[model samples]
Target: MERILREPLETYSTQKTQKFVGNPLANKLRGEYQRLLEEILPDRNRYLVVGSPGKGNWASCPWIAILDSLITDTAQSGYYPVLIFKEDMTGVYLSLNQGVTRVKEYYKRNAKNVLRVIAQDYRAKIEIDNEDLTEIDLASRNNNAKLYEAGNIIAKYYPADNLPTTTELIQDVRRFLNLYEELIFNDTQIDETKNLTALEKKQYRLHFRIERNSNIANKVKQHKGYKCEGCKFTFSSMYGSLGKEFIEAHHLIPISTLNLGNVQVNIETDFAVLCSNCHSMIHRLDDPSNLELLQKIIKDNLT
Candidate 1:
């Protein structure tokens, strides 16, 4: 990392001055440096490590990102833990960051603003490793650096002269990866704006958890009282006007497997009127169809 911080600056400048075409530094960043970082990971197969010196032109702030394989193979989308060398080569940042490419494409000239907004949204919900690292500084106004700074959800800076030991670096990466799993790859708790860019899969997955037929749902809710069957919690009683007639209709049987034979759903027998909490809890069960077991679990917890 120390070598990466120091060596790249001089090499980049020299190559750019001569109107460089091919990049040896890019090769090293993606190959050797990436391999070095990969060695520290607990399971390398779960991560996709990649580095970039620049694209067609030399980047003022080059980076090497460790991406979660399930979420993103490239840094263009989803979130990742990245090592971004400062534009001035004076320092580097280990950032838990968003992918700027997707943001830029969607938000265009206002991408920076949206990136900052999404970063705030991410920080609000998850447990952050570093409470102080809510933002980062790349010390340059380059487009990439600016986007990276705005996209930072949380970060720890490493000054060029005083970098951490390899062990410490590995620990930080592991901590950041854990956060990444919770906030980005967990496929649950995706809140805030559904229209937020770079989170198509997560947002859709959360929405797709229950494929509801609205007519059937309304009829089912009519048949069942507007109270949580699991805990007898009434939303209207708690919140008054805002929660009137508000209750979720949950299908006891898995919707995907409902097509077995010539299946027909009976609203009274197959549906449950649950509060959001109970509905979410039931989905975590191995067999959500077992309403008796779910009620027992919830009852035991209360006692």
Candidate 2:
């Protein structure tokens, strides 16, 4: 384990560590990290594992990021509960990374309240940057555990002698996400607004819906193959190589349930692989078109 932690730092001192997506060594290190996380969190299976052994850019320092599956989707719709291991730094950190996502501003608006909840709920000491956080915030803030990155706040969990157990770490993160859900995604006022047109309201609701869980989609495509889940239509087979490897990801879970915030998505159960035509037909209506329902429709048409 110490060797796993030391690998990136050693690699980065000479050059940036390569991307973790297909690297065996980097992946093994993440597997070890997952083992450590699972030992502490009983519900750890629900979380998707993500991040790289080190930031690939030549200028960036060595770091490992393990992100929650739901939040790791696209960096826009959900909050990423991250566990970061910095080679130069002594211990791992429990952080909420919204900085890389499109919703950084949304998090910034409620940062103060979010910090308060973290402190009151978990008894964890946290730090926040006083200045306004911008895109540059990502490059500038580092090494100083004293100031939390404002756009996406973070707190140290394993600082040398004061390493937190898995239970303590889980409690801290859960408390933080609960408060985040309450403050950000639970707004009912927008739905109740008296001023918007029908089309406008539709657009408003879409902000919560269109964010794709790519991890689930990619996993489904890899395991299930790129054929349409409903009709078994293979784009490549039909179009001769031009359409190879191209398929759409459809969310099988009902859309109404997504607004509840922090909902755990079961990749195997919640998504389907589809061709473009079937995907469009399924979502022709506002709600998620049911998989079984669509299958029946296709069967009937063929008959």
Candidate 3:
């Protein structure tokens, strides 16, 4: 069985890997890899074997890549949890492939260095555009050595005793991607309207009101009541009936897309009500803090 597993990586030449996609031995090797991954991963549905032995460009080594579906619908655009085995070395690592390359161009031109930080977090090797997938090869070693080393690094973040079920891991990865997008692509924009009146052109603009539907705000007040979703500040309780319907509505959608012509906003999912103070603090940062984060801050402060 070990020999079968090693055959695709060790015995096969580069040409063989490219041409042996349908070969019986190659299929068996690929199947075994999937079986082993199934034992380690809980939600088989969350991942797909997008790349396998004997199914890559001629210059690339034999590898199996398990993709996180939440990050990308296809392997062509997202990163993957990859197990790469080459004659000189092997290691399980994260490979940001063509899909990620595309994202680097379109969504985050400034984020070229973010993946390096993620790799450092895992202590996992990084590979950008090299089809050879050889950047992870640290020294001359066997396939099992590489797998063991990679497994240890993965186990550090996801231990065997408390393995993150595939679903949990996918969610974690999604959050990581969100934070990455937030940190790397966060752009601070200032209103640049020209010919402001003397008062409007003041050095410090005290506030800017983003347009929102008053009906939606009223519905939230009706359904959820006028309690701050973050710190649970109730206006009526604090300030009598005058404050009953005074909670501010914050749109949860990305600020960049809020005014797009065809953009749709679902009140329940897209808005949160907050007390005056919390609302001000949420927008204090260049990017408004999400309600969950604000709630965490409140909880943390009390505890």
Best by TM-score: 1
Model 2 lDDT per residue over 192-301, tens place:
53465655444434333333446556776776788898899998888988998889777676754454334555667767888888876876544554788888889999
Residues 256-290, candidate 1, lDDT per residue (tens digit)?
A: 35442233567778788889998878766656656
Clashing pairs in 3: 76-99, 77-99
- Model 3, which residues run further than 4 Å from truth? 1-5, 14-21, 29-32, 54-59, 87-135, 138-303
Candidate No. with top lDDT: 1
Clashes of 3: 2
Positional deviation of residue 45's Cα in model 1 after best superposition, in angstroms: 0.6
In order, candidate lDDTs are 0.74, 0.50, 0.47
Model 1: ten consecutive residues of lowest lDDT = 202-211
lDDT tens per residue, model 3, 58-103: 2234555565442344544434455444444232233323233344
The per-residue C-alpha lDDT of model 2 at residue 107 equals 48
TM-score of every model?
0.61, 0.43, 0.34
**Alpha-carbon shift of residue 287 in model 2 (angstroms):** 8.8
Positional deviation of residue 9's Cα in model 3 after best superposition, in angstroms: 3.7
In model 2, the clashing pairs are none
Report RMSD (Å) for each prediction in the order shown: 13.1, 10.8, 17.6
